[model samples]
Target: MRRFASRGGIDTERGAPMSKTEDESGTNAQERGDGSSQSSVAAGRAFGKAVLRDARRGAALGAGALQRGGRLLWSRLAAKTTKSERRASPARSPAPRGPESGAPASPPFGRRRLRRLMGAALLSLPVIIALSAAMAHILLPNLEEMGARAEDRQVFEDAHGAPLIIRGAVPSAYAPLDTFPRHLVDAVIAIEDRRFFQHGGIDIEAIARALLRNIRSGGIAEGGSTLTQQLVKISYLAPERSLSRKLHEAILTRQLERRDSKEQILEAYLNSVYLGSGATGVPAAARIYFDSAPEDVTLAQSAALAAMIQAPSVVNPLADLEALRARGALVLDAMEAQGRIDADEAGQARDEMAALVPRPPAIRYGTWFSDWITRSAETLAPAPRGVSLLRTTLEPDLQVAAERIIEQHLAAAGSGAQAALVALRPDGAVAAMVGGRDYGESQFNRAVDALRQPGSTFKTIVYLAALAEGFEPGDRILDRQLDIDGYTPVNFDGRYRGEVTMLDAFAASLNAATVNMAMTVGLDRIAQTARTLGIDTELRQTPALALGASEIPLIEMTEAYGAIATGRIPFEAFGIRSASGMAGQDRIALNPVPGASGPQIDRIMAARQDMATLLRRVIDDGTGRRAALTQPAAGKTGTTQESRDALFIGWSGDLITGVWIGNDDNTPMDGVTGGGLPAQIWSEFMIVGLNLADATTVGGAKSLETTPAPAQCNVTACRRAYRSFDVSDCTFQPYSGPRKLCTR
Candidate 1:
């Protein structure tokens, strides 16, 4: 012991020996009358010398090891060399003593020494892996502290910008970790990471077990990722399976563990982890699987959902019931093994979870409208990267009203029927559109997709052509059976009104009179008029076209009438208000400037004022009498043959609404006419819910009557002018104006 102390440079009788430099500095301090400072300085100097001596000895040992490693490496390289290369080694060549040979090479390590060195290297491998893992964690970026953020969730809203729903990779609502039942958290931790709280981000024991299992299975059947590693994998690293990604995930996991507590990590993981079926987080998963809130999730349901964390698609409760129950059993076993639940409790929980099955999520109303906005938004810009806002023209009140009316009407009518209602401003901004009775039942937007014939409602187009062709409002025509080219046309009542004025014929929807006018003015002219009004689809030029035989979409028909309601350029229907994100910025203009070139609706209505009068009379006393409001409401009613389709499209003030009701299979309703059910529904929607007072008449007032064409030479006023014409052959009277034919 005395010899060992002396070698360590400490005196046995006293303490550590004073160094020469400390002895000199202490004498100088004593000379300045600071004896206490001298002794402290002497002790510090001796301790530093001892530390330096130990460091020098460590350096010598490290150098010796390095030399040994070099010899072994050179010997291995020489062993691998070819015979010709081996001849160049010093062992195979003659010694050279010339000064040009810079220095002598160390001899290669003997085979025994090489084996010893290899044994030392093998023994140090585990230590090397441990140190490397520690260094990797230390060098990792401070991601948890740096505050990285995921993309903001996009929100779908009502037309007026009220938030309706949120969509993304998942919909999430963060909650405190304690809010979940203990079994719920235990189930996740048990199956995913048995040693979650004990491990420092990565568990070597778990990894070893996983590797062994994978090797035995001859495939990657197990994943050893701890909870922290999974969090780092999904949040920070790319989802690709590669060495670099795994390295990055491991590094970020350690960094995450250092900065956040176990509870915080659990909260974040439970909030954003993808549990399957578009359930991004635990809250969304609970709601989607149970139709209940997160806090209300039952233990059995929670275990089933937790089992999905390992292989969500493979263990989908809805798709593979047996597989899901098996996974639930495994989770229960793990929980019991971890002492989180007693064996009896685990058995009872397993039995309960075995009976659990998937429940379809309850869909909220108005997703059709949201989907419509999504489709329209895709056209306006690229898909949203972050939150996107779609400003729509939908009125919640009117939408609710329309939905209620369809359900009531369908039940009362006692038929399996479908109805669509679309209401818009004169400028074409859609206000309310109930495309079907229940959007949850069907997403097919019938308002934009259905094409039905507008029976007498199309007569407006035929008569507009007649008014422009010099026929006055009083040009009487016979509403009797008429035949042309072997096709006879009759009135809806199948009875003849000998001769009725144009206004009376239109009010009663006298088919023969309307057909007579169509033949006289030409079918081509009527089609052109309908197209100009707003009907974009093809129109037939046959006489049947005059009787509303052409198939046109309901929206197109409503917009065509909208043109006549207000002369302004139609507002192209749009729902998206604005789109913005990390991608870029885009916005939609609310009111676009009207074009100056087209035939204006107000102008055309003003020119054909007599047509407006006829429509008003129809609503007042004719087929559309049921649609009359407190004010002068002008609209046309249309019912197809056998009442196959019923339509009531009209305008009050600048607001135009069109309603269509029929079976999807085109089965005729029991005596349902356009003027009966459709008109009443239109009245209910417009007056009861839409709340538009008759602010202005559909068209203001009647214009001056035009001079009748000279083809009508039956009246006494034109008898002298038509000297060679037979008055008895004419069916209508002539006009009393300065006739261009009379001038001859």
Candidate 2:
């Protein structure tokens, strides 16, 4: 048992040891596994608890930040309230947060709160901008005031109340929106603003497209302004392209859209938009282009007018017919594309346009007269509120004749010379006036504005002064070269007769003799006589004054001669007869009738009769022979130095006319004497004007019965009748009498 026990013991020991080792190893391994499992489970539980705590803290912080942001926003909004509310409310203290409340103190402007405030500011940015824009929009100009200020219309009418010209913002015939033809409206909309009705005031899509186009074209090829915007521009804004102006226009356009309906805005636009050649609206355009009413405009005409909206000056029917037709075709194509008109209608319109032949512009008769009337009306009647009808003294027929005559003479002259003619009644009423050769080429009213030397025509005043100073026409005067006060007077022909009667000296335009007579008659008396006859220009006190050296206007000079014709002193010429308007008619005050019955009137009549005899002698036997008429005519021919100015002023019956031919720059004409072109023009015009043949005179018939017959006397009897005699011809001449006698 011992051996076996030993062996058994060994075996048992080994076995038991092995078993115990195995059991112990298994136990240790099992225990170690169990401990590892427990540790892992504990670690997992700890980690999960830590994560829960962190999540809770984060949620709490987030909630706190949101609450602070809400408080801040509320405070800001509340601070914006009225100060009275702030004063009436109780002030709230910060909440108690020390030991009484189990919460930690929060720092002012913490990171989370800063972030929250930034987010709130970012959220309210668009609202702030929108509010600012609204306030700015409210502070713009008043639309109604602008519209009222832009509603001015001026329609000028001729003497017979025919529409002569239209001017200003709105035309006389302002067609309403309803009066616009359907095709016209469609054409305008298609070409100018396709989405006119769809836009409020500005079209964003259109603007973008225009911007892209402009960028591509490298210029402003398109203006994306809607109809509302265009109306605003026309009615309120100035015509300037600028960023600031565009901004204001955009704002005003929005205001207009808000204030007026689409139709009203369109009506205003159509009535005020400027279509060039002085047409301000569609009505004026229709009347001017087609000579028709706006509603009666044909489809092709409508398209053409609509095309003018883009560039009126360049593409009008008068300026460029082909350009207008091309633009009209584009407008028609656009209309067809917009479905405003079908293919057949578009084709018909195209055919009409292709068949269209532009009418030649009406001959604008009496443009200078019309312009003068317009200017005169400004002061005469002050252009009462709306349309003014100035009944002028302008006889249209006479004006037409005068224009044709002037054109003919100037064309024949062809020296780049200009002429001015002023015709007046014996009573000083301006009948016809041609200011310049072409009113379109130049606007200078030479008749009323040009101050030129009267040359020898001024001798009439000197002779009148001499006559007033008791120098009879038959008085003997030495027609020799004379020098007085360092001034020498020579005859036009540079030849002088030793002795001649005053009538012969006057008829021959003997400068030296007239100057000598002027010296004897006193220069002051001559100036006074000129003023009495209606010369308003300042006269110089010199001997040259006798030789017509005074610079005077043609109108004033003509009026002075009118005094001679009418036997009236201080005669005033007038153009406007009557100015009729919305107010009562104003009969323009004219020069009073020759009612003076004193010695002054008697002296004027005597001087006029004597001067008439001398002037008749000039036409009968002297320099003014070219100015003779079928009936009795009297005039004076005046030629300035170097032929710079040539004039012929005359009267037959109750009509007195003055003609002047000269260069605009005071350049001399090519050997043009007073008796040459000027006298011829005067004679031709007078023949037509006086209607000596089949044509009766404009104002009245010639008074042949009033003309005194020439005196018949022998040499002895004529010498006894006058203080002088023509020894060369053995003729008796009376210079200061109503009639002159020559022994034939």
TM-score of structure candidate 1: 0.55
lDDT (10s digit) by residue, model 1, range 537-654: 8887888898888888778878766655554323244454455431345543444224222222333444455666777888998999999988667789998888888888887744
Q: Give the TM-score of candidate 2.
A: 0.64
Residue by residue across 1-744, what tens digits does model 2's lDDT show?
111122322222111211234343355333567776456445644554454444334433555666777778667655554444565535564567866898886644444565677687566555544433332233234465455466544445444554454222122455558888998888898999999899898999999999999999999999887888877777788888643455468767776787778897887788777888778888788877887778888888888889999899999878988898998998899999989999988999999887666653355566666666667555643444433445566666677788898888778877578889998865456778888888778878898899999898888888888886778889999888887868888787789898899999989999988888888889987886776566778999999999888899988888777777766554566666555442445433432233222333345557788888888888999899999888888889999999999999888866788999899999989998888888988888888767634233433323532533222224554466556555444334455543322322
Q: TM-score of each candidate? A: 0.55, 0.64
**What is the clash count for each candidate, in the order shown?**
2, 2
Residue 413 miss distance in model 2 (angstroms): 4.8
Model 1 residue 86 CA deviation (Å) reads 33
RMSD for all candidates, in order, please. Answer: 21.5, 31.5
- How accurate locally is residue 195 in candidate 1, as Cα lDDT from 0 to 100? 92
lDDT of each: 0.66, 0.71
